[model samples]
Target: MKSSTRSLGARNAVLAVVLAIAGLAAQPAAAEERAKDLFGAEKLPTATAPQSFGFYSKGCFAGGVAIPMDGPTWQVMRPSRNRRWGHPAMIATIEQLSRDAAADGWPGLLIGDIAQPRGGPMLTGHASHQIGLDADIWLTPMPDRTMTRAQRETMSATLMVDEKTHLVKDALWTPRHTALLKRAASYPQVERILVNPGIKKKLCDTVKGDRTWLRKIRPFWGHDYHFHMRIGCQPGSPTCKAQEATPDDDGCGKPLAWWFTQEPWRPNKNPDAPKARDVMTMANLPKECRAVLDAPGPASAEAATYHGGAVPVAVAAPEPEAPSLPATTASGTAGLPSAVNAFTATPEVGVPVPRPRPPAK
Candidate 1:
């Protein structure tokens, strides 16, 4: 009887070992999971306090808020991508810009991608929007009528730059265009406004009077259809990494001249190499990001959407005072071209307009 019992106990131990190995084999290694795939799968923002971690290209953010798809002065493009989410300050800034741009004679704003709901490496396109501080505003003006979901996706943005000459097409360029960019650069929170090299050169050649605000307009590639606006790190995110400041001088000299050279447009020698997003795994991001991934999200996207007024103070710090402008342009009207109308009326729209939210008690 004792011999028989010993044999049965040995068999049970071997079975236990076999089961443990099977369990290990069933789970994929964390290091092998790509960060983009993990972040791209998220559909909503975390309900906790907002904070950004790591650099703009190599970070993640929590407590994101989505701007409504259809705002009174702006309409989000690419609705199917579900990329309108951003930090509360970013959303507020965009909303403010749209209203301000309208006052400056631009019809309305057609916003491009902001960031994924959670703000991390995307599955496709963009390398720096991971931190929720960057946004793309199409140079194309919002149409007079509300765009259908299908129209928003299919509409193509106007290309302002000539491919061969790398110059802004003179026919499409207008004084109002320059005024719009000027208004955008006036905000203190906006640290950088990246545009096509051609657009930068045009501004350098034409902008007269005080050119101080031109310091914030950066020249980069692939901005023919839209311009990129990047805000500085906010107060609540202790871990948020800030980008280097632009030089004090307007960047219209030697640096802007380089984009005109063939060196920048040269064909890639090794196009087959994988992009950083393709290989980045969870191990590559900040340790805090792991917790952000696991944090519970809101019940729906609407629950986390911004409805105007100030974002929670815990998430969005108070807006800094705008830098003082020259007395001549302090009213934001002195410099506009004669063609611009200060009081352009809002056109009729088919979409439902969002009602103003009551003031917080």
Candidate 2:
């Protein structure tokens, strides 16, 4: 009887070990799940209060708002990408820049990618637009007429840099282009404006008088067709990481010349290696990111869209005294007739029309 009891006890212990192994196998491992796939699948922003958690390349955000496909001074390109979303402050800044850029004599803005619905690593393109503060504005001016949705998707942006010489194509460069960059850099909230190295060289050689703002224009790869505008972290998000400040002097010196050399252009040594986005799992992101991913989203994309005037002023840093710029021809929405002006007319979708005001008591 003692021998039989000992044999039964050993069999039970073996069964327990087998069950433990099976349980672990049944559960999905967080390490095996790629963050890009999880974040890329999100289609809408959380309805919670806006907060950015983590670095621009390795974080996520909540309470995102989408810029309308068509605005008075701007039209969002690549509408199908569903990337027009950003923090309320970021959306407001873009709208404000559009108005300011128009006043500075450039045509309407052809807006590029802002961020995915919930800012996180994307399925493709960009390493830093993950936190809803980075935006890409095309070099090509908005055409005179409103573009069709199909056209916006198919349109090609004009390349401003010559690949062989690494220089701005002289014919395409204009004073208005310079004015647009100046207008963007003038805003205090704008921390950095990234452009092609060639474009940086062009600005360094030509800009006169107030060269102070040129300090913010950074030289980077692949900005030949568009310039990237990046704003600093805003008021409520304590978790948002701030980038290092640019040097005080105008960057027209040896740093700008380095891009002309062959070393910077050398091909990647490990082309087959995986990108950080490809391998990043939920474990790699901030602890808050999991909660952000699980949070509830708005009913529709339109429900969370920014329609102007409600943005908190605190989101932006105080504006510095305005810089002096050359006077240019008046051509933005301000001059457009009310009948044709998009600002006055109702947008086709995603933006609610304003209700008639009650008569004053």
Candidate 3:
């Protein structure tokens, strides 16, 4: 019996490996087609359109949806220029989450924000939260669990929606918020997740016993306020590459194979320590949240050791040199912010900006 069981396990492992290779073999044209489709659309404005949809041949749809929550339905921020039409599978997931919430008699399952870009280029600047595929969801009690006021505060802080505009305020995590997050890890579309160090530790602990699915995902340092959820998006592909849940790098620099077998999730605490807050211009923030009277975003995720209590990150300046003003040129002024403008022969797409509004009382 033992020999037969061992053989069966070996066969299953082989099958899994074979399937993975086969999947890779089939990704090129599909990936190319996806790239073409993604880039072929209209010149992406600085951002994407509101709630566009993307459909993958493999049966996934991802885009914007306003899910009803405690008060109003949550509205996500979309890029002003480009929007990936969502696939059906993603749509079904949203519908099912709403249905499950309703049937379960919950207040509301608010999908506060999606695809709020924390970092990365090409898709950076102008508007990141603009990507329709990303989402920031509020942490709700597990259907079988209860939520406390502290948990609510943690959720509220973690959710960090602009009370006035209801877009993702920012992404950050704390110890309390981390516990709540482990409960939400079962969603199928989740690819890589970012969180505070303490939260990652708790996740490592909580899933130690049996959350095998957690193994398929990785974690990173998230800015305070919200957790960044990375989802898969590829239209016409039989399978989503980024969608396969995988093991985390255990940024703590330890092997985590025994993580599921351990008692409590013990994530690295040092790297997750809160750093001094960075000052951002109101112009850089989502327009809706600009109304926040005191918009100091949560503490930073990295620390600087100058030893002053929470000092602002210093900007290094160029070394002083003998000053020589630019020699006057015949027809141009030097060293002024360039007044560069693009003049397309045809009509061009312009990025949409949120009109500023008063802060919520």
Candidate 4:
């Protein structure tokens, strides 16, 4: 029996290697190139139509707008990442949240990764945030003065979790943190807020009554220093997809208990773990993304006009030209941001959806 099993395993291993080789042989060079560098692309495609396509991770965005690095109530934390770009609705929401944070105390807010200028998979770090709807806000309080660009790039987020106990480090964590979490959760447009399990536990223990907002404060891995905020599809873009809704429970009981158990921390026993993230191909993306990559650079003046003082204005900084495509209709551009200008030449294909007003207070 043992010999027979060994022979079967050997044959399977040989077959797997052959299949892997065949897969690579079949993929076109364009697909391979996309997997390597599309995510790391620095320049926004020439087209300035603000839109998101497909699901967040498997999708892309075009004509993305930049969130100002320094606002009245917030400072973007990581400038080098060049991830301050997002859909206009997301940008407006962040600005609103920053002011809300200031009203609650703590020297305004410290913001982190928004998305690449045209959203797609990141060059490194994070499997999500491909769409402009996700952002990271540091738990660390922003200082009352303007920070240098260098400071923004190098600063580390203040850790809140205890390594051994997997709980809030009692000394460093404070009630102010709880207050901030509450404020973020209260925003009507926000769909979910991801934090370390420790932070969720802290909320579970301290809060007295009325746990309605707690349902949105989801516990996820590796959010000790900052919380991740996600919004549903922007109103204007019909093709934007929403993630499945969270369960009805607050997630502080059985769901929370699972994270603390030995099972989650154990090494993967299955030798056949699926595949690495780097293996994703252009085929893995929505068909429209090819157009996103091929779209021409905007005219110099038009580019500058769109960016303005919103960001550093690298609009005229000389980007590599994308290879041209046979003319295709703008129908594929159905889902994206509102036009940069009501008069600019971006394709005017679909009607943008209007956002619903908040419930009466």
Q: Candidate 3's residue-wise lDDT over 100-145, tens digit each?
A: 4444444334344432211111222222233234444444323333
TM-score of 2: 0.79
Ten residues in a row with the worst lDDT in model 2? Answer: 336-345
Candidate with top TM-score is 2
Q: Which regions of candidate 3 fall more than 4 Å away from where they truly are?
A: 1-88, 98-107, 115-131, 140-183, 234-245, 248-361
Candidate 2: stretches off by over 4 Å: 1-31, 311-361
Tell me the TM-score of each prediction against the true structure: 0.78, 0.79, 0.34, 0.76
**Residue 193 error for model 3, in Å?**
2.9
lDDT of 1 at 178: 92
What does candidate 3 score in Cα RMSD to the true structure?
Answer: 23.9
RMSD of each: 13.6, 13.5, 23.9, 7.8
Task: For candidate 4, write residues 1-361 as lDDT tens digits.
Answer: 9999999999999999999998888776535665426756755433445567778777776655666677788888878787877765566667777787788886778999888766777777877787678899999999888999999888788999986788998888777888788888777677889999888998998876778789899998899999999877765455677777766678789889888887667777886764333666677877766766766544432342222214223242345665433222246653333233212433333223344333445
TM-score of 1: 0.78
Residue-pair clashes, model 4: 7
| Pairs clashing within candidate 2 | none
TM match of model 4 to true structure = 0.76
lDDT tens per residue, model 1, 1-361: 9999999999999999999998788676634789999999999876555566779999888778888899889999998888998877788789989999999899999999999988889999998899888999999889999999999999999999999999999999988889889988888778899999999999999999999889999999899999999987764566678888888899999999899889999999999999998888888888778877776666677667776664431221223432221112324444322122111111341112223223345
In terms of lDDT, the poorest run of 10 residues in model 4 is: 304-313
Clashes of each: 0, 0, 42, 7
